[model samples]
Target: MVDSLEDTIEEERLELMVSPTGGDPTLRIAHFLKPSVTSIDGPISNLPLDAHSFEDTIAKPNIWASKVAFNGWRNPQKQWKHWVHHMHSLHQSTWKEAGIHEAVMNSTFEIPRNDNLIFAFAEKWCCETRTFVFPWGEATITLEDMMVLGGYSVLGDSVSSSLKNGELEQIHEKLIQAHLQVTRSRARKADQSTWIAKFVDSGSEIEHEAFLALWLSRFVVPASSAKIVAKVVFPIAVRLSRGIKVALAPAVLARIYRDLSLLKDITVKMKTLNGNEDDDNDVRVTSLAPLQLVQTWIWERFPTLRPNPHLIENDAPRMARWDKRKKVNSENVRQAINSASEHFLWRPYAMAANGYLPCKLYKEEAEWMPVGSGLDEEVSSLARCVRVSELVGLDCTEQYLPHRVAMQFGFDQDLPGHVPRGEQTRKIAWENYTRPIGDTVLYIPSRLFEADVTKRYLDWWKRSIFGGHNVTKTAREQRSSSESLKKTVLHISNEKKADNDLLVPPGFRPKCNMVEVSFDDDDEDKQTLAKLVRKIPTESEKSLSRENGKPSLDPQVQSPSSSSTADNGTVGKDKCHVKPVDNSIRRKLAMEDSEKEAESGTFVHDSVSISNKAESSSLDACETPGLDLEARIGKLEYAVAFLKAAKFGHRSD
Candidate 1:
């Protein structure tokens, strides 16, 4: 009777879940119906394996000349803060207009490179899946990571969208010429120093565009040279100058994936060579990707491997959590990483102290939503991240597989289905990369769900790891080697602790105290200039004050309450300030203002139309004042007539 009942329960469970081999796209609930059963089996894979090979690559006496040195971007100087200060208010207004203020703000915070930590983590990176496989499970840096850590927007026009044979193209050409004229070079490119000197405070109409161009070239997709590539960056910079948003996160992620593959290939080759080659013939690899992002990802997910980070301020970007320099001993990184399974943070952002706030992408319940279903931008962005699609970059493309790591997105895991990589799939992925596919629905899982794998998935994982392999022999050998290395490291640590009582304990790493550093007279001058700029009033604010028949109040003398009310919405008598007006209300007000302008023979494009080109083409064609008024009026009349026809046709039906 008990066996019969167990069989009945299994049948019911099978009925509720779709087979992994089935063609259905809808996600099943079977993965979440039961709790995960821990497998008693040993390490799942060779991952978190010995890191001696990677450590030895960097352990050479001339470590600075090693290939791993090129893993991260060149650190910018403290003086770079002056450039940020110069463009502070302009950047705020421009990025807000472009609908990328959140991303832009996050990009400004500097994350100091921890070379030892990065190298240690890179050893475990699997190039095929673009993930770091560990003993517990697989984890990867995804589009979500780019959005959170680097402040790149997932919802925007493709990076390949360029100005083509339009007024925009003319504008782009003129901006390119400005760079050439500033540098006085035959080449179209300009060096960073020359670009900054020419455009920082030039007050020219193209100053903002030039600044963005420099930023993209240096920070976003930098090459080995110091010169900014006008052809690659200028078009996007021009679009941004016109307040157009570009999907930057996908492209950034593609570059990271490509570089990581290259880094892995070179590292494998070096390991094979085993120091047999001469010094002159040694292979030196350089990774152009922004590896600081990879380091930050590891720091966020691995508690044991993380160094002490800086305190984060309210409303600041999460990247600000690592703004301080951290001191780490390279020697113990392998041991820490090996034992990180118990200390790993599966969902770090869910914790309030991690400095992540609930955004629009978060949902309370799991549901299927059609991509590009005229949904909110945040919802659409989240859909793009979760879907199995191809990520297009400037020079490369990569496949994204969120289904395999469903747990990372706060969903329970089952056995992941096969991902189709045929030519037809690639074509479809490219053509509809930023648009909605016909009748296709994307799974938007809830963050509130418990992230765990089903019992069947655990069993399958164990079999895959232990089956067809001599697990007994491999486990024994690995255990023996790992223990020997640990004893050696522990003995060395003890000797060092005895000699100098300052050595940290075996499993406990203390935080480094904040230290103050003195600056030069040039730094003081930059600070003075920044303060003076803050005191000056913007032209619009000055005009508004003059119209109101009152002198503008000095910013420094303004009361906290008045400034707070003006910056945010009006404050309440209660402790918490009143919520700011919703986006819907703001859009309604903007439409009303546009209608008012329209009566005066001016047609202002709405934000929605500006973002969607198909909706804006008619308005764009009528932009020139030289066009006949009757022609412009006829276009509007035709649109109104078409809408009336559609309404009457619907009513008749």
Candidate 2:
């Protein structure tokens, strides 16, 4: 069945390529349909040659000395919550129809930045290929990352597409006028704060439009300034407000690529200067891209570097997991990245969710699907994510290469074939960027399974220059240190357990020294357990009383034959005698006490004060002769029952 699907997909791909009006006439299909290479004898073009050089640059103490900034834009104000709620309530169906409900809802969440982590990752990014070159393998922020983490859509109209009618233009003009009216200035740019204060909950027709403008300006493609560029973000906001779907993932990925390239270039320049430049001439490079996505990507892939993220419910945006910030220094982050080969998660999202349902694009069975203009939205989206193409953003155009990291897409990795990047291919053409232009045929795999690499790819990876030699040495050192730490912890725990065991008597010792008890809020069982535990004598108290020459607390050691007990007439004074009992008798007594307590609705408080008082009163009884031993034995049995009941709850007979 799978073979038939593959054949059908291949036929469709060929038909589409040969059709006169289907694909790009300037480009040839053979360029993309080339198979993976088995081996390479020389250096591959565009691949990073020296991994250690880049690693050293990032590890330097003065890497941040060149005024690098990755600060994110200001979040939406608290007062804007009302406007968001209103828009959600009023246009819930429209947002969903446009496939941006999750994006809009997710925009409200604040994703705190970890500048150190982002800087560490950006240092390793290869600008030519748009992937972070690690010793383990190649990995990059793909369209899937943008879609799943940033809540952006992979399938929609091009972000560069302009409105053909004058209605949207008029609405745009009204928004500008409103901004001008609020600011009372002739300046073209509108202050973000002023715009939100004037239009949020104003009950005007353009309230929704204004709210979307704020979202785009603050979140989608944020600027360094606090002002909103009406000419840039207003049109996209108007389209989104009118239920028009915009392909945001590509633009987002493009901007990230651009920022990463910029950051990498500046770092390289700083490295070239070797810290010899004057401080007065330092140039500050502030990134305007949404770098929250970059930080979230790092958190998802590298487990050791990130904080413990909050677990969200199923179907929630995955980005919500990292809503808090963690403090990290440059030294630790550099060390973690250096030894991240063994810990990098190639397919982080392949793990089964707690209660997740499979979306339309993901399935349990692997099959080949043809994706293009006429295909399903999910299929088309998947194709766009897995294909190699150019991503066009508002300000930049960057290359997208999914083949170098095929393992990320659930495909078996092979030697990556060279992808030609001619001038025409790099052009920022909206029509080329909007559709799934590369590899019309793609293999979709089950979400739960991760396909391993081919033997040839593995062999090539071992010999690849991009794989750093220092990575193995650093990883081995880290592993050895962690193992020694674990052994030290285990040794301490063992000594503590041995010390605890010496204090407990043989028969009364607990089965497990570490007792884990959990109780619900305000539960009756919890109160009952607490009362019983308070009554039992501690090991220290028992040892102290024994040292003071007081009568032993163990009921078995005390003689039952006493004159006071004989007066009760419970047992004949001459017939009754002390007898030794096994551990089974104590266990049976506890079970009987639990049953009685449950049936009669009586609670027994075996408190330390009560026991001390009883011992004091019975001091003479221990010396008395001709007393009934059986009558006194019953009292000791009751005391033992409380101890057992406190430690272990009711047991089945």
Candidate 3:
């Protein structure tokens, strides 16, 4: 029956994995078609790669070819493998820094000639610093030796060395090229920043300034590229002020404490509905003890192929849909890979000719693009874990999108959906428009947002706005209001000059000294100096001179002053005192002294003493109220003496 089934499959459920080289092309067989092309144990009786098998009937219960019926989609995995062969065939580059070279590449890792040297070199750079530490899966770097890059450099005796050393031999085959550098992390002082403000550091000055220049040439050039990038620096600044962290990663990921609770609930609900009676006790469970031999065989071949490089929904075998639920034709799967590749190429190709990107972009591209199986990274990432509920036995009756959050979820049951009402099925959208991929990398950190320079600049250029503006910015504005203001002010802010800016008077040369000038049409603004001049006194009226207590009434008078006595009696020099009477002219001095003393005499004692004092003073003393009070008392004393009124005839009036 098995032989009959093999013979029976003609063209009905079959597809081509690779595009046929010659002939009808329509006659190509099922691809990704894991025939016994490479065998582990047995002498393969009927290999699928045979020319005869191309036209002959094959033994399989189900299969499909990438005929027009499959929408011209080829098997992504098969095509991917097919590519690896071609790529490997053309690849030839020798590297010798760490005993790695082209001839020994398969043993260590082969370098395709076109592979980016910068990307290859970057690993060495990263090797120098223990500061930056990415877990194996974080960046574009393939996780082989459990290495991380792009943060603080490591200390010689740091904890990271312990983590990295154990896995070296396993990845002895892989090599990447990239450029990395350390920045001057010292905070600039206000005094030092003054120079930066007057003449800031140029793109040619920063250590990575050259790298930045290269990125801008390729990715952010004018009129040549196709890609999209989305950044929200200002919005991020606003959110950061509210205390969120890591703008590249979402708030939820950073605040894992909050996430763990929801994750716990989800883990519970998923375990329940997805549970089936056949789980550990399915009747179809046969003694796969036969496969135990195969499993052990594959396990022994460690450094060859990783069993689960893509560690998310589909790649992780435990999380994958049961073989029965996989309805996509193998050929259709390959086609998906092809489409993704073409999509990936669009940005790099568009920006490649421009000088902004490094020559090494293509280099890294070669290193990263392995079999088409590796290309599914776009859809298969752990970042796409949100889509996990849809792929298989996952019963998401309870699970919904967690990112489409409009507002936060106050309760546990209603998870904040990221999608809005009008676009319920769509992913959450940014409220603002973004710039093209090319224009974005023109700035410092904006391009840094991406993992590779190629993607960094290419993505940025594609995201440029309509007017060739690369408005998308680098994010994760890390501080609060005061700190943020300081950070942003370092770059001159784009504020418009106010009308009051011109209001700073241009010298003291006005047409007239205040009150003399009045005009009907001058109502437009009341701030002209002529009108405000008198209300505020001349400099002389404001201060007294020490030379004398009186102020000089001249505009250009020079006396902060030694003899200026202000109306309030404030004096500058002369030990800061009031004008004193001159005893040399006793009459005038006495009159003045008497008058001055009278004004301070309230309604009280020593009235006769004032008489005696004032009578001895000059007439100008009468000008002083104390002198008048003294004069009146002197008259009353004389009248009392003349009429003897004080002794006996006193008048109460």
Candidate 4:
């Protein structure tokens, strides 16, 4: 017992030395930071001794040196730990000076109007952990936890009031239902063949739930707000990447665009309606990265040809570096401009005790946001330097500059091959897309790839499908059968507009009219008709004779007054004869006789026509009573016309 007690005491002593003041082990692990804590060169030394002296701290600015100090700094882990501790101390001092805690505790108290106060409040509040003590136990909470716990109290009352109360759960439910509907409906429609369909089917339940939750959160408080969407959605989007390739569906994308745009416009209107004279719109001032804002939309509507995961993972780190670099460059430009304006450096800091940086720093020219620029020379040449606060005017222009620029000059309006921007993309959507037949592929132009930087987008997309690139082979064949080959091919050309010079051949259908002749009343006419039918070769017989290498011969062309001749040219006479027919019947036969007469007088060019005429004449002279040749001829004409009508009259009917 004694030995154990001694060991415990020794351990407690070591713990005290390692982490003094009962602070977190992580924050307390700063040896080198201790020396700089009271150094005259340090930022804290510049602060007034009295923490509550508002005039000096609020008026002055301070650049919070990065924990890393420099890109080339050694032992980044240790250095960052120390930096966090120093920044926290600075944050607490500022909060004390500004009485922020006192303001939050009171419902009626107004926050400081200074931008620095708000900025520091938000930054420090986010980074620090709050200890909430209850009667039974104590709980450590992060900013997110505080957001849920405090709700309207933590987020401004205006935001809470503006949002529809109790709509969050309803929205989540809607999103879940929509996701399930998309998965099942798409799977059934495409036979579970699409990549999205298969992913939903094969993915674990946890992954699917995580995706739904992450996507639904986009409509929630912090995520919905453009200021923090990058910080919130980016990580979630990356986490859900394995199961879901696209960030959001097309419908969801449209909703997000409309919502964010409306929110920005509505904020000012709301303030005016509430009788607040503070007409300054803060929404437009914050720089929301366009690519990050509508990431899902870009992935769904304008998918890249290839996905480089390694490069994508590097974005956060690169953004961090760029942000730091831009801040330093902007400050340098500000200093030069201030010198030209003949203002003394009252306090040499980027941020005051409050969170806001002077607006002039942000208003520096786009060119000035880089290193090695002769800012001193440029500032000297300027006729005048505007006041720092006027820089807020530039914020309105910065709100959606990237998107505005892209729409006006990018592929949102005009596209290659003279095709419109959204048409080609919309065609290939899951609900409406139809695969083309026989190795035909969609060709999207390089100009249309403004949103996606994939070199071979089509090829990569084809490979991403479940059945490789040829998943839609059966669908293509079905489409080909339903539509004519010529029409189908032309439809593709017109829709894609990949080549304006493409020519579409006209479609055609062969015309076939079935001939029908009625038997005359006379027995002789009936007999002649039967004889003619027997003389004509059947279709099969004709084909068989051709296959046997036999030449086609015309049927016997014997007139009523002449004898019939065989294929070998031997004459064969028939004893059936008839008296002269009635005038009406003769008139019906007149056209047939006239044709024969014309053939005999004029050299008969067509032997087939001559044979038909001779057969008709024989039928006219058949030995039978009351044969109505006129009626038979009229019926034949009517039958041919009706056949043509039946073949092509469905459209009008």
Candidate 5:
């Protein structure tokens, strides 16, 4: 049979009734169609119309009316003072419209006797348009006032016995002031902060001291109940002091502890209501649980064990996010690499050409490259883990699954190298700087890494003003290298000369007259000759004839045949038996010879010259067989000294 849509649906009947057990009691409010203003049937008591004034101008301004009106407004230095002034004006206007100022001054409302009455009073205030404009919620008592209510109300009997008359009012006033401080200041936006922060942030030192005084005001509570008072007001005091720095009196601390204890009890009560203890058989019977009717509860519990559907679905979008991040990182790394290269190499080289060393400048620039590169060490480590996972394949351990899964969707690692771009650039620049510059074997200094006007100024200060060392490290190194190169070049030149010597035939003497050639009179050549003469022996030698059975080389004593053989190179090979003598004896001998020549006065110069030449030839021929080559060289040097004396000594005389 074909049925209509309405016929297929089942309808249930609904009715209004009182609340179930543990729920709020129903309020029996009496609604009036056209009741007179004097009629009193609801929570609000009958107000004396004659005493109450509905006029907006009912209250008169105090002596400091203008100052009070513009209190925060005039303080241009205070943040959000103007906004506070505007809000105050709105509040004043609302108070005037609702006649709340007159009500507060002239009327007194009774505290509800029970929780139901209290709830009803609160609801009436909340729903009423006149009370809706009041701050700190529509209830007559504010959240701050709840502390006092804990002491006065039935719910707070345990702590209430501890509080005395007027103590609750004083606590409420202090709490309201603290709360108002946060709400009035710009710091009000951070309302979640502690009370100390809010209060201290609200005003200056003077205001802080004033609030501290309020906290110190003595309460009427007894000594025994002081502990209970402390627990009840502890949180309020903390809120008051949130942003404020003040010396809290012992009394205030005690009250704060009392308030806190009450709060703890209240919390326990709330938890008891919502916990398993409250899940009684009544709830089970009233509320239907279709899941309980299931034949297999085991299969039903499987859904709870399964992973969250949202989490599984999130993988795709999560990968896409990572892909986007990778692309950005890659771009950043590329830019950093380029910047680092410029900072490391090109910039520094340019600075060097300008005669500036900017190591610090390059260092500062290099430091920035890593920040923009976007690949922190964490991501690089993750990439390593991913690579390890890939190599290990599906058999890889579960620990690295996150990194592997992240890279599974063909997403490149795009991770930076272990060495930072800046460091790499510095390393490269330093390497190139240490090595030879271009084709030349000269190295550029690493100190000359970067350049700027500041570096130039510092260099100038270091050089001109301070009179510091002129040579830099690079310059010193170059100078030492050049000196080494010069020595090497000289050695190579000597090697060429030695090679030339190999072409000369042995025993083939070139008959060059050693004594006949005139010496150059050039100043440099004379200096060179003087140096060589100074190096030759200046001390006198002993006579060989003293130790030998032969006569010495004296023109007056020697036979012509013996002198001829001696002059001929034969005696040059024989060792002379001699003892050491002084230069004075040799000089005296030369003078005597010259005097004798002068005395003879018959061309003695010619004979002396011939004798001198013959002596030189024999000295050269005497190889000094008994002595080493050094002794023979010494003998030749002695002969040269004697010749100089015979020729120059007589002329001076």
Candidate 6:
């Protein structure tokens, strides 16, 4: 027990000496930090000490000087045992001063906003140790740095007695810097990830500007809004980097932003809305990096290629007509466009937040969204009425500028193609998502990755049996056989190969009019009827030879069944060998089938058209003699059939 106690005392002594220089075990630990923090609350404009009274004692902007002093110092007394807790306390101070805390920021986003908003987020901390030490001269101290440390010091000598509301005392500058180095050294010990290393390492820069912005946006002034950062990049770079060409990148990048074209008319409306014509609407700003340059280009071009087909139909109704020279098939383009417009070109972020996922938001529907250049309408559409706040995941009722800005700061962090991982990432969303899966996972939260970027496609129908069209409860279904329609109208009718240019050739369907050669069926009706059938787009018609009135969709299209050719192809090429299926009688049978179809609401069963006449059991309808007489008559009929075959040379004479 004595040995263990001695070992602990040794450990404590060495730990206390961590802030001192010259890495030796025997050096005395300095009483570096003894502080009594007056408080960490109230507006930036007002200070605890009256400036008039302290005018001769302090420098101009005493608060600013004190902050500079605090940054330069740390606890010389070695008060904090946990290194992480020490780092956390320093980080809290940064956040508080950087306007991350609410009281420091200006109400209007106009001016006087703190520049380092991210570093200002204050944390809850209390030190009941009641330690106090005021720095006198420069053993390892600057007046500014020492004054800043006083802002967080606990006063008095005992833990309970010095538990005053506030006190101001100094901390050693060496200890403060030493603490940061220690944490970074520990972070590098085991292999920590890149992001983790940055957070722990003092030398590491804040790579994610958006994260800082998001935290600070809630309280910072509006001058540093995402929009403004977007604009001032060039000049800001010029100031920071001192390079003319680097400064010009923002302008070049800005020009690349085609939203300028969208901004022209919007500027006018914005000016009117704000009651200020002098407003510089041309200055569209954002903190998003240059990668967004490509995204901006795509956003501009998408509106053209992905315009609602209905818009073209309404504007230039003839746009849907077939144009062979154009590489894109207009109808297919129409379907995809209509689908895209309904799905917002697969950008379901704004819509996915809601329950529904209709494919596109059409131009007519989008008219309300206040999109792009030129003022054609007086009233704005549904898009403009929408607020960025609704998408912010929380309410910002009052004017807390930093927090608001912070909310949007993550915009730049919404990295393209970045897949999020981890528990919190799983429970909520931090990455782009895909379509829903089953009842539990109904919605995907990912950004709208382009289809080309999606990398894989799967056959949707093969996984499940369609059963039949009636199985679907969806209302959009119709009796149209779209699959068959394409083969007939597109490939066969135009006589084009499936892999070739779009027109389907006529060899597939030799005759569009399967009508029998009886007049009074007007030519107009025949043309109209042909057009209707051709419009189906899938029916692959071809040269058909048949034994009866039924038309077979066969050249090589139908099955090998012998009964298939009994349809609309030329029937009975020879009278000799046929089983004597009377042509008129077969036609009469077809008429009866048609009547039954009409009465039953046209739900024609598969057997109705496909069954052969030989399969029909209509014995009672046919005239029959007595049993022995009927047998003799059947024999005579067979003999007659044999004689007819011989006469036509169907059998050897």
Local error of candidate 6 at residue 12 (angstroms)? 68
Off by over 4 Å in 3: 1-83, 87-270, 273-443, 446-653
Model 1 lDDT vs. the true structure? 0.52
Cα lDDT, model 3, residue 619? 27
Task: List the candidates ranked by TM-score, beginning with the highest.
Answer: 2, 1, 6, 4, 3, 5
Question: What local lDDT does model 3 show for residue 319?
Answer: 12
Best candidate (score: lDDT)? 2
| Residues 1-653, model 6: lDDT tens digits | 01111111000000111111111111111111101011111111111111111111111221222122111011111221232243334453543332121111111111111211101100000011000011100011111111111111011011111112221111112222333453456453211122233343343333122222211122111122222112112122112111111111112222222222222223233434442324533433322211212222222223433223221232111212111112222233323322332222223112231233222321111111222344222111111111110001111111001111111111110001111122332112201111111111011112321211000000001111122222222212322222111111222212223422222254442322221111111111112121222221112111222332334321111111122223467421111112222323334434433343344343422221111223322111121111122223333444335434432232211
C-alpha lDDT values of all predictions: 0.52, 0.56, 0.19, 0.22, 0.22, 0.20
Tens digits of per-residue lDDT, candidate 4, 252-353, equal 222323333333233323333442334323323222212121221111121121122122131121112111111112223222321221221111112221
TM-score of 5: 0.12
Q: What TM-score goes with each of the models?
A: 0.61, 0.62, 0.14, 0.18, 0.12, 0.19
Model 5: residues with Cα > 4 Å off, grouped in runs: 1-44, 58-653
- The candidate with the higher TM-score, 2 or 4, is 2
Tell me the tens digit of each residue's lDDT in model 2 across 444-549: 6656444455433443455454445443343344333422101001111222656545544764442222212122211111122222232233344344456545
Decide which is better by lDDT, 3 or 6. Answer: 6
- Report the CA-based lDDT of candidate 2 relative to the real structure: 0.56
Per-prediction tally of clashes = 0, 2, 93, 13, 33, 79
Which lDDT tens digits does candidate 5 get at residues 508-600? 321111112121211111111222221122221112232324333211211111222346554321221111223343344444333333433
